[model samples]
Target: MTSHADQPNVARTLTGQSGGEIPRDDWSAGRGRLFLLLVAPSVLLLVLLNAYPVFYAALQSVRNGTLISPGEFVGLSNFAKVLQSPDFWHSVRFTAIFTVSGVAGSWLIGMALALLLRAGVYGGGTVKVLLLLPWVVPIVVSSMAWNWLVATPDSPMPTLARMLGFETPLFLADPLLAAITVCVFKVWCSFPFMMLIMSAALSGIDRSVYEAASIDGATGWQRLRYITLPLTARTTYISWILMTIFCVNDFPTIYLLTAGGPIDATTSLIVLAYRLVFQNFQTGPGVAIALMMTAAMVVVSLILFRQIRKSGGPA
Candidate 1:
């Protein structure tokens, strides 16, 4: 549709010579305005909902005495108390175990499932749905269900143990056993999320790489080590970081199930904070403990994200 005179003009070309009117990019300003308009409410809401609470918590942590009717500001006294508490250290130790075990177990199982799904086994879709069901259920409901299955001697597992010539297992009764049970329960509930993310990472790998590795006589374990592991290293690290946060901050899984006991054996930092604030009515130390957890989370997340930046792809 161009005229012959216009066709000969260099300004009409994509290179934008000065012989004709240049196209205006007016949308850039409009887009910036629109973006701010759309994002402002969310930013405001985060400030109100998230940032305000954190700031308030920090303020509360420095204040002495109860939740309401604040006493004199005692800088770092609450944190010093929390740091010196034996119960706090116990909670921290168990929390570390629970986080490490739950993250490792879930990631290994999830990555295995992702690999199986990527290999396109029979009924993969159905299996994926079934695997997702545990995570899809409400935590309260799942925790209650697990309690029924394992918390009592009359439960199915204990009954089965009796039949197998073993004593009725007290999953939540003994300290060591309770720790193991809570960690396993957390893994069971958390693995489906890991599976979902790992599946996405697995799909992005080029099949040609694996084929070439196979032709070069790479064994199954070698391919897994040199190709799959290296490729998905970043994703694995990210998954571990997220799951650690979930496991550390978890309250319902421990409270609803064990209430941080078999004599306080399963108390995590979150549960300890709740017990201090609500049960013991020590708001200052409680908030200080919570802030400590937040600091730990920020440190861990930054380290993991740095690793991700260093890696080029899924790895």
Candidate 2:
């Protein structure tokens, strides 16, 4: 007699497959196969379009020429030069300032707007719709609009400043001011995305949680502190990370606004890379800078991910 451990269920024998077992109760197996089948095309496209170009840029960073003209294999020379070059360092510094400022500004303003709008006060929907307008506008159109608005002599902000008795500050002319200008514009243009994300996350939160807190003698601030924020922290962290990356990579607005500026003052890494690749035709250094930017962003993202995970949450 066969051991019970070796015997197949009686249901298997009815199918006329001797000693065969039914499939394990792993629900994900079939779904996983189907998911891979569905995602294969997208994965292939991503590899071809994004991954391939990134790898190609990394490869090109080592050599010293354009696609049309072959040059010497300089190994790490391009990266070293990029790191040490004054212009590249300036760009890196500007990029860091812009990224940090823009991310903080966007998150702060967006979170405020999200919280206010979530209170369902008067005109909340209208305010949300208006806030979304910036995000819906094309970047080029928005860039041009900002350029016309601020860079022009007769723009609103300057006019208002003059009217208020303060000397009209040339927003785009000064390097420090230009950086602040870019940060403000970036925040204005980007906050809608954060607001939307925060709104969704806020909506998913259970009202019962707040009610439960209220019944326990929790004040409004107490409810927000203990219950609302912790539950929403993960989404907020993700929003901040995404905004940081976008701020790091933002180009069109700054490019169109200042073209890296009155004296390369406004140039960040992206603009610097553009100047290298297109203006100066230095493909190797350009690719090196791009790779550096990508690596930095990856590191920041990893740090945030680890922190979020350590907070006993999934991000």
Candidate 3:
């Protein structure tokens, strides 16, 4: 007499059933339907919210139009005009500089702060809250405060410069100084975000790994360079991608601080697009610039995403 364990399908055979388990094909089909059902609402929402605007913008980009009217289609002439414009190139240059500075400066400062905090410094919780104030404050309030700090010769920054026997630098007036100020401001506002992300990543690292490395005679710098950085690489890549997007798309920082300024000195692509659409009422060219920026952003995001996958392991 064989036991049931020796014949797992014995009950099904005795009961004249096909099998005790659902068919693989049927199970897969059922799961596929459930997946579709679960995601359908989100997909529909994305189509309505994101896809429609992008489609409308793509349509408007190739046409001569005002905000109120979709004028006749001109077939890439808007793109051509934007490409030929000197102001567009100027904006692109500033945007590149601003994005690079913001990403690098924020990451360096934030990572340093994160490492410092990881060492269990005194009153680190209080310090972290203080650090976050730059990011947590309303952007409008922050912008207003920054303007008061540097906008005039009578402002504190220029006043300090005068006290130091230096010619009062027109931070928002001079092209180069305005660009530097905007980039620095972006880094200041953004570093706290980077700090939070890095802090989380650092906390997830096992302390034992560092203890073992120390046993092997690894110095502090060596542990950081070899162990800490490698362990946090995926997070680093992700943070860089986010910060890059933030810096590239940041309009308010530059606009509020400088209004693209004394002679359009700090106009980023977004600012230029805004000036064209809202200020100049050139909808077609404005949308064209915006679409170009979107394309560039997509390309950059893809590149960084690939790096993230690489850092995380086999895709």
Candidate 4:
């Protein structure tokens, strides 16, 4: 019904090539520009706040500096000194123990709680809120409460030990006991986060899959092993990576609980770095330690990221 000239114009309009509407290519370009405009401020802020400090720290790591002034350039000597220090190695060992215990213990407890909650236990909402209180409470307040419960021979834990006919256990005085206490405290404070993560991942799974497994005569443990775990593998790896970083970078947890004390038995790398920078005024070595920690974290993250990819990518 249309004439030849009119048909061409109509076709152009349909394809968004007419003067009244933007062409597809132009529209795409415009959208991209708008996205960049919206994201530019956040990008700039990240570069300023995170990137700049990391760059500055990298430079400082190569120089023998202090809080007062940037001292002589020392190349990698600071790193070498840190690596050779017995105290540094001691802290590294303790950090390894702390991180492993925190991650594994919290994950196990959280998974169990998540499964229990998923079963629609009575008063689940209230129970979940109660479980979350440890994480929700201010760390400072929690630390103080823990300190009061274990800091002295007259403390509640020690009193309980006495009543049980055992010697007064020095929870924060003995090096080994202090280390154990800190690691356990880290687990207590962190498990709620893992619970929330695992809960969400479990919720995403299809209920029909479990029903089918049960119909096929699969046991509860078998279904969990084969179906629940595999389906949540991506989320599990992500949580591990996040918790690893959190454990590595955690400063206040150990500091407030033990102050790296009795003999620095609970000192993590972050605590060691703090001592080096502020207490010892060895800025270069401190920053070098931090950089080494960052490198190690990157390696761990990449390994877990590969696991996530194997588990069908991110959740």
**Predicted model with the maximum TM-score:** 4
State the C-alpha lDDT per candidate.
Answer: 0.89, 0.84, 0.91, 0.93
lDDT of 2 by residue, 1-315 (tens): 677865665423333256554454443476689999999999999889988887778788999998577577999999999988999888888888888888888777877788888787788888789999888999889888877777755888788889999888788887777878887888888889988988898898888888888888999889778887788888877887898888888888788778888798889999999988888889999999999888899999999888789767775
Error of 1 at 197 (Å): 0.7
Measured by lDDT, the strongest candidate is 4
- What's model 1's lDDT at 297? 92
The candidate 1 region of ten consecutive residues with least summed lDDT is 8-17
Tens digits of per-residue lDDT, candidate 3, 191-256, equal 999999999999999999999999999999999999899989988988988888898889888888
* Preferred candidate (lDDT higher): 1 or 4: 4
lDDT of 1 by residue, 145-250 (tens): 9989988899988899999999889998999888989999988998899999999998989999999999999999999999998898888888878898998898
Better of 1 and 3 by TM-score: 3
With a 3 Å backbone cut-off (N, CA, C), the pairs that clash in candidate 4 are none
lDDT of 2: 0.84
Please, what are the lDDT tens digits per residue for candidate 4 over residues 133-202?
A: 9999999999999999999999999999999999999999999999999999999999999999999999
Error at 229, model 4, angstroms? 0.7
Q: Provide TM-scores for the models.
A: 0.89, 0.86, 0.91, 0.94
